[model samples]
Target chain A: MMLANKQVVLKNYVEGYPKESDFELRSSMISSHIPQGSKGLFVKNLYLACDPYMRHKMSHHISNDVPLLASFNPSSVIIGLGVAKVIKSADADFEEGDYIWGMTAWEVYTLILNTNGLFMIKYTDVPLSYYAGILGMPGLAAYIGFNNLCSAKEGDVFYVSYAAGGVGQLVGQFAEMKGCHLVGSASTDEKVHLLKSQLGFDDAFNYKQGNDLARALKRHFLKSIDVYFENVGGNMLDEVLLHMNLCGRIAVSGMISQYNLKKLDGIHNLFCHISKRLRMKGFSEFDFWHKVPEYLEFPIQLIREKKLLFVEHIAEGLAKCCINFCWYLLWAKCWKEDFSSFN
Target chain B: MMLANKQVVLKNYVEGYPKESDFELRSSMISSHIPQGSKGLFVKNLYLACDPYMRHKMSHHISNDVPLLASFNPSSVIIGLGVAKVIKSADADFEEGDYIWGMTAWEVYTLILNTNGLFMIKYTDVPLSYYAGILGMPGLAAYIGFNNLCSAKEGDVFYVSYAAGGVGQLVGQFAEMKGCHLVGSASTDEKVHLLKSQLGFDDAFNYKQGNDLARALKRHFLKSIDVYFENVGGNMLDEVLLHMNLCGRIAVSGMISQYNLKKLDGIHNLFCHISKRLRMKGFSEFDFWHKVPEYLEFPIQLIREKKLLFVEHIAEGLAKCCINFCWYLLWAKCWKEDFSSFN
Candidate 1:
C-alpha cells in the first residue's frame, strides 16, 4: 500500500486572475476506513470539472454568501464538481466501488465527510468522467439557463459568449436541437472554427480579431439577437446589449472578463436592455438539480447515438494539476501561451 | 380664431445632457381645422407629463425608434403624452369639445391629423391632468412593468429605485395594494418620507445618504427581494442585483442614471443576477398598451378609494415646457437642488 498520498490543496484565495501559485500539490497520509462514528467516504477522484464559475470561487468574499451556488474556504482543499469512485464508505447508502459524482476536491484522493446531496452514478454506459462536466453542473446549467430562465423557443436566435468553452459549446448544440439559429464568440481562430465546424454553430466569430463586437454580431445576426448566453461579461455584454432584439433574453452564467480586474469594466449600453424589453437572468446548476434526470436523459441518448460532441483539454498527472488549473483559467481569459514551457 | 401658435420646439438633437439651450419657443401659424379628407383633431392641451424617458427622445437616434417617440426636430415642437380637449374635429371618432389623450405636443393648441390608436377619455370626473401623468403613461408603465413584466404577487417583497419619480412612485403603491411589502429608494428626505408615509411603503431610504445602496437595502429587507422595479440605474442597480431572491423578477423600465451620462456607468454586480436565478426585464408602456383597461380600473379604484397616493412636479405652461423638460432631466441625474425649489 502507498503510505503517502499525492494531493492538491488550496494555497490561498486568488485575487484578480487565478494562477498556478493559487494551488499547491502536497503529500498526505490516507486511510481506507473512516474515523469512528464519522460519516465519510474515501473517494478516489477520477474526473474534475474546470468551469467558468470556478473563477468566482477563487476570489475572496465580496458579500456574505456572494455566490448562491457555493462558497470557498481559505486553507482548505479547493472544492469542485467531480466524479469519484468510492473506495470505502461508512455511510449506509454508499458502498465501496460505487461510482459517485458530486462536489469534491481538486485532489487525487479525499476522505470526504459531511457529504450533502451525494448520489451514485447509476448511468454506467455513458462516459463516467462526464459526471464531472457536461453530464453534471454545466450541463444542467445549460438546460436550466436556456429553458427555464430564458424560456427559449424554436426559431429564436442565440449568441453565446465563450462559445468554445465547456458550457457554451454544449448550449450551442442544444439551441440547434431546439431549431434555433445559433451563433457564438470564441477567443481563438481554432476555437471559432471548432464552434462553426465541429459544434454546429450557424456562425462563430473570433472576438479577439473583431474590431467591433456589436458590429460583428450585427453582421451575423441580421434580424437581432433573441437570446444571449453571457459567459464573458464587460465589453462583450455591452456589445450584446446593443444588438439585442425587442423582448430579448440574456443568461448571465459567468463573467471571466471582469474576474481579474480590481474594478470591473462597466457596460455602457445596458439601457438597451430596457429599450428592447430584454430579460437578463443569472443562474447556477444547483438551483435546477431537481431536473437532472429529465435533463440527462436526452443528452445521454444523444451521446450514445453520436449526436453530441465535446472537447476536453486534459493534464497528465497530479504533479501538473495546479498548472493545468492555471492553464484552464488562462485559456478562459483568452490568454494563448504555452505556460508548460515555463513550468 | 386665435392663430397665435405658441409652441415648444426642439432646438436640435441634444448631445450629452439636455439643457434649456437645446429647446426654443417658436411662434408659428396655427390651422384651426383639419384639412379636407384628413383624419385628425384640433385640440387644446390641458396637461402634459414631464417624464424621464423623454430625455432619451431628446437625443438623436439613441436607438432605432427613439426619434419617433421624441419628435425632436430642429424647429418642431417637443411632443409628449398629454390630456387634451378636442376643440375642432374632422375625424369621425372625435367630436368637438371631446376629451382625449395619447401622444401630443407640449403646446397650448395644436392640430393632430391621422391619429393612430388615440383614445377618447370618456369619464373626465377624475383629475383630467391625471390622464396626462399618474393615470396615463406613467400609470400604464407601472402596471405593465410590475404586473406583466415582474408578475408581482401578494406576499412578494417589492423594491423600487427612483421611488419618488413618476413611474417608480406609482409601482410601489400598486404593489402595496396587492398586499405586498414595498421598499423604495429616493434621493431626498421628503421623497423617502412620502414613500413610507403616503405610498404605504414598508420602508424607504434616501439613496444619496446611503453610500452603499446594497447594504441599505439589506437593512430594509432582511428577506430576499422578490420583485425589483428599477428606474435609476448604475450603482443602485448593481447593488440591487446582489439582494434579489431566486426567480426574482426585475422590471427594467428605464435606467435614468445612464441616460444623460456622457459615458455610461458600469454595472459590476450583474453577475449576481445569474447566481440568484433572477429574471430582469426592460419594458415601455406601449408594449402592453392593450392591457390598459385592466390597469386603469385598479389604480382608478385605488384613487377613488383614496388608498393609493401620487405626486407630480408640474411646470405650469408650454412656454416653460423646455425649462421643465430640462429640470426633469436634472432631477433624474440627482441635481435635486435645482428642481427642489419647484417641488
Candidate 2:
C-alpha cells in the first residue's frame, strides 16, 4: 500500500533569520507498512513542537559538532519531536493503536526506521498533546534544570527570563510550588499577564518595556536572587549577575537572544560569578536522563491534582509563512504570541 | 616608646589607570608598646602581596558591600596582608619574637588591634615570603579552586591563563601532579617559557603575540579541554569557552583583566557553558575555611617533598611611586614584574 506524505522541507540554507520563503510544502509517497528488517513503527505526527532549536536547523552555518541539533539538508523533511499514534510496527515494543512520542518528521505519517528513539506511551490519562510539551523534552528540560541545577528551595527568591515560554513557564510554576517567590519576564503584555495571573508567578514584566534590565531587576529584587533560571541570555545574564546573591546558581537553558545573531552580544560583570561564588551551568535535559523515571512521577501527579497550571498557544497546522514569523520572533529573542503554537 | 612608621599612602582616589604621582611617602609616630587592654600584637611588616583586588579599593567607585576589601582615606596608610614578627603582645595566643601573617597596614612597624585576623606562624621552616604568596591567600585560592571547584582528573586536558602568576602557577602544578596534560598562556615570552620549562606545563603560549585566541587554543589543545583555570578573564575566557569539552569545568579565581576597568571587556562565548554542560564557578578561599586543616596537609607535604615549585618576585622598601607602577600594570591587566613589592 502507498501513503502520500505531506512534508515541510527546507528550501535552502537560511542566513541570519529564517524567512517563510525558506521552506516548501511538498508531497511524497511512501510504503504504508513498516519495511522488513527496519524494525520500525510507522507514526502519524499529531502535534509538532514549534521550538527555537529548530531554527538552528534551517541554516547551513551550524557546525556539525553540536549533538541533537544537526542542520537539515535542503529539500529534506524536517525532523522534530511530536505526539503520534503508531499505525504499524515491525518492532515488538510498539503495537498498532498505541500513542507514542519521539523523533518524527513534520509530515502526516513518518516511518520511524530507528526504534531506538521511539518512546512507548505508557499512560493515556492526560491529553496526548501534553506529550509534545509538558511531558516531553520541554518538561524534562524544566524539571532537570529546576531540580538538579537550580536546587531551588522554599522561600528562595527565584527569577526566570522568557518565563512565558514552554520550559520557562514550567520552571516558574515548579519554583512557585516549592514556596519560592518567583519573578518572570516575557516579551509581551499578554504573556506577562498570563505569567502573573494564570501561571502563578509572583511578578511578571515585559522585558521589552524596560530600558535598564539591571535597574528593573534591582527594583523587584531589593536584596538578591537565589536561583536564576536563565532561558534567554545576553544583557539579562549580565544584569542578573549583579543581583545574584552569594552562592547563587544560574541554570542556562537557552540563549534565544544570541542564537540567530552573526555575533553574540557581549556579557560583562561576570566577575560577580567569582566575588559572590556564583555557579553558572549550561545544561541540557540529557544530563539527567538517568532520573527520568524518578523525575516524571511528581509533575504527572501535580497535573492530576490541579495544582500545576501550564500555558500554551495551540494552533493546528502552522501557516506556511508563519514558520518565518516564528523564526522572526526567535530572532527578536522572545515571542509575541500567547505562549506557543503547535502543528 | 615613640617610633616613626614610614608609610605609602594613596594621594587621592584614582580614576582610570593610576600614575606615579598618585602616591606619597610619609612618616608618623606610634607607640612601640601595645596599648593597655588592647589585646593586640605590635609587629613589624615583612612582606606584602601586590594583588589586583587591592586596585578595586584605590578608586572611590568601589561598592562597600564587598567582603574584607575596604578603601582607605586619602593621606591614610594603605592596608594589606603581610608577614610580621610580634614585637609585643597582649593577647594569650601570641608572645614576643613570634612570627605571624595577617592583614596589616603598608608600614614597617604596625599595631595589629585585631588579633582575631592574625594566624600564628606554625610552619616557619619555609621562607616567610612563601606565606605572602604560596602558603597564604594565593596558595589557598589555588588549592580550593583546583580541588574543590575543578574536580580535576587524570588524563584531563587542563589550561590555565597567566600560568606563571602566583595562583595560576599553583593550579597548573596541581593539575600536572594529577596526571593531567596542562597548557598555559602568559602575556610575555619569558613567563610562557617559565610555565612550560620551570612549572612543567605541557605547552605554553604568549597571548600578546596572538590575535585569534580560539585558533591559539585549538593549536595547543587539538582535542577538547576538560578544565580551565581562569585567572585572567575577558577575551581569553570567551575563547576558552569554545574549546571546552562536555562536562567541562571552569574555575574562575580572578578576572584581572576587568578589575581596573571603568567597564569590563565583554565575553561573547559564555553560551558554550550551556552547549557543553560547563560548570563555571567563581569562588574565594573564605568559603572553605572549615576545611583549612584538611586542605593544608597535602600541599605542605608537596612543598616538603620538593614536588611543588613556587615563583615570587620579592622587593623590600619599594619606592612610594612604584605602587603606582603596580596600579598601572593592574589597569593593563597583566604583570611585567613577578609577585610583589612592599614598603
Candidate 3:
C-alpha cells in the first residue's frame, strides 16, 4: 500500500540567519506497509517540535563533537523530535495504534528504520502535544542542566537567559521549587510578564529594553547570581561573568544567539572565572538520557498537581512548521512550538 | 640604635607595561629595637620573590573577587613574599635568631607588626632561596591545580601553557609524575628545550615560532588534550578549546598575557565547552591553603630524591630588583627570581 507524505525539506544550507525560503514543502509517496523480515515501524507524525538545536542541523558543517546531531542534507526532510503514532509495526517493541515520541522527520508519515531512538508514550492521561515540549526533550534538557549540571540549591540566586524558551521556562520553575531566588531574562515585555506571573520566576526583565546588561543584572540580582542557565551566549555571557557571585556555576545548554552568526561573539570577561573561583560546564540532554526514568517522576508529579506551568504555540501543518520555525528563531519567545493537526 | 632602611616604593599606579621608574628607592631611619609592649618582629630581609601576580597589584583597580590580592597604594612600600632573619622579637612564638618566610616589605630592614602570616623554616637542607619559588606559593599552586582541580591521571594527555614559568614548570613536572603524556608550550626555543629535555615533558613547542597557535597545538597534541594547565590566557586559550577531547578539563591558574593589557583579548571558541562536554575551573592557591600539609609531602620527597627539578634566576640587591622585575614581565622566561643580597 502507498500513502502520500507531505514533508518540510531543506532547500539549501543556511548561512547566518535562516529564511523561510531555505525550506520547501513537498509531497512524496511512501510505503505504508512494513516490509517482511525487516523490523521497522511506519509512524504518522502527530505533534512535531520546533527547537533551537534544529537550526544547527541546517548548516553545512556541524561540529564533530556531537556525533548524534548530524547535519541535514539538501532536499531531505528536516529531522527533529516529534510525537507520532505507530501505523504499521514489524518490531515487537511497538504495535499499531501505539503512541511514541523521539527523533522523527518533518512529515505527515515517517518510515522509522531505527526504532531504538523511539520511546513508547506510557502516560496518555496528559495531552499528547505535551509530549512534544513539557514532557519530552525540552523537559529532559531542563532537568539535566539545572539538577545534574548546575546543582541548584535553596537560597541560590539563579539567573537564566531566554527565560521564556522551552528549557529556560522549566529551569526557572525548578529553581523556584528548590527555594532559589529566581530571575529570568526575555527579549519582550510580554514574555517577561509571563515568566513572572505564570512561570513562577521571582523577577523577570526585558533584555532588549536595556543596552546595559551588567546594570540590568546588577539591579535584579542584588546578591549576585549563584547559578546561571545560559541559553543565549555573546555579550550576555560577558556581562553575567561580572555579576556572578564567588564560586558560581554556569550550565551552557545552548547558544541560540550565536548559532546563526557567521562569526561567534567573543567573551571578554573570562578572567572572572579565575578571580571568582567559578566553574562553567557545557552539556547536552543526550548525555544524561539514562537518567530519564529518575527525572520523569519529579516533573510528572508537579505537572499533575498544577504546581508547574508550561507555555507553547501550536502550528497546524507541515508547511506552517517551516514558517513558525523561522519566526521561532527570530522572536525567541519562552514558548515551545507544537506542529499539530497534520493531514 | 637606629638603622638606615633602603626601601622600594610605588611611584604611581601603572597603566600598561611597568617601567623601572614606576618604583622609587628611598632611605628611611628605623629603630633596630623592637618597641616595648608591642608584639612585633624587627627583621633583615634576605630574599624577595618577583611574581606575575605582583603586576596586578601594581594596577589601581584589582578585582574584588580576590580580597587577599589588593592593589598597591601610591608611595607605599611594595609588599611581597620574602625570606628574612629575625633581628629582634617582641612575640613569644619567635626568637632573635629564627629564620622565617612570609609577606614582607621590599626593604633591607622591616618592622612586622603582624607575625601571624610568617612560617618558621622547617627544613634547612634545601637552599634558602628555594623557599621563594619551588617550595613556596608557585609550588602549592601547581599541586592544587593539577592534582586537586584537574584530577590528572596516568595515560592522560596533559598540556601546559607558559610551561617554563614558575607555576607552569611545576605543573608540567607534576603531570610527568602522574605518568601523563605531557606536552608543554613556552615562548622561546631555549625554554622549550628545557621543558622537554630537562623537565621530562614528552613534547615541547615554542609558541612564539608559529603564528598559527591552532596548528601548533594540533601538530603536538595528536591525541587531543585531556587536561590543560592554563597560565597564559588570550589567543592560546581560544585555540586550545578547539583541540580538547570529550570530557576535557581546564584548570585556569592565571592569565599572565592579559594582565598588562588595558583591555583583555576575547575568547571565541567557548562553544566547544558544550559540544565536548568540557569543564573549566578557575582558582588560586590560597583557596586550598588548608590542604598545604598534605600537598607538601609529595613534592618534598621528589625534590629530595632529585626526581623533580626547579629553575630560577637570582638578582642581587633591592635596587636591581626593580630593573629585573621589569625585564621579567616583558621576557617571560620560565625562571623564578630571588632578590637576595639586599643591603
Please provide TM-scores, in order, for all candidate models, with all chains considered together: 0.93, 0.94, 0.95
Task: Evaluate model 3 with DockQ and give the value.
Answer: 0.80
How does model 3 fare in lDDT? 0.85
lDDT by residue (A1-343, candidate 2, tens digit) is: 7888788877887777666777788877977877677888887888887776777666664556666666778878788888899888888878998998878888888888897756766767977888888888889899889888998899999999988878999999999989999999987776778888888999988877767776778788976999999988889998889888889999999888876677888999898887788999988885565565666677888888878866666566734424644544563453554345421
Off by over 4 Å in 3: A332-343, B33-38, B62-65, B332-343
Enumerate residue pairs that collide in model 3: A164-A334, A165-A334, B164-B334
CAPRI-style docking class of model 2 based on DockQ: high
In candidate 1, what are the lDDT values of residues B1-343, reduced to their tens digit?
A: 6577788888787877788888888887787867889888999888887787888777767446433354366677877888889999888888998898888888888788757857788656678888876778898888777777878889999999988888888888878878888899887777787778777889998877747665687788898889988898888888787788877888888888777877778777776676677777787787766776666777776677777776766667777777767767777454465346534
The alpha-carbon deviation from the true structure for residue A122 of candidate 3, after best TM-score superposition, in angstroms, is 1.0
After superposition, which runs of candidate 1 have C-alpha atoms over 4 Å from their true positions? A1-3, A36-39, A66-71, A210-212, A332-343, B62-71, B210-224, B245-247, B332-343
Identify the candidate with maximal DockQ: 2
lDDT of 3 by residue, B183-235 (tens): 99987777777888889999999887757777788799889899989999999
Arrange candidates by TM-score, descending.
Answer: 3, 2, 1
Whole-model lDDT, model 2? 0.80
Give the whole-model CA lDDT for all candidates, comma-separated.
0.78, 0.80, 0.85
Candidate number with the higher lDDT (1 or 3): 3
Give me the chain B TM-score of candidate 1. 0.92
Clashes of 3: 3
Residue pairs in clash, model 2? A274-B282, A282-B274
Ranking by lDDT: 3, 2, 1
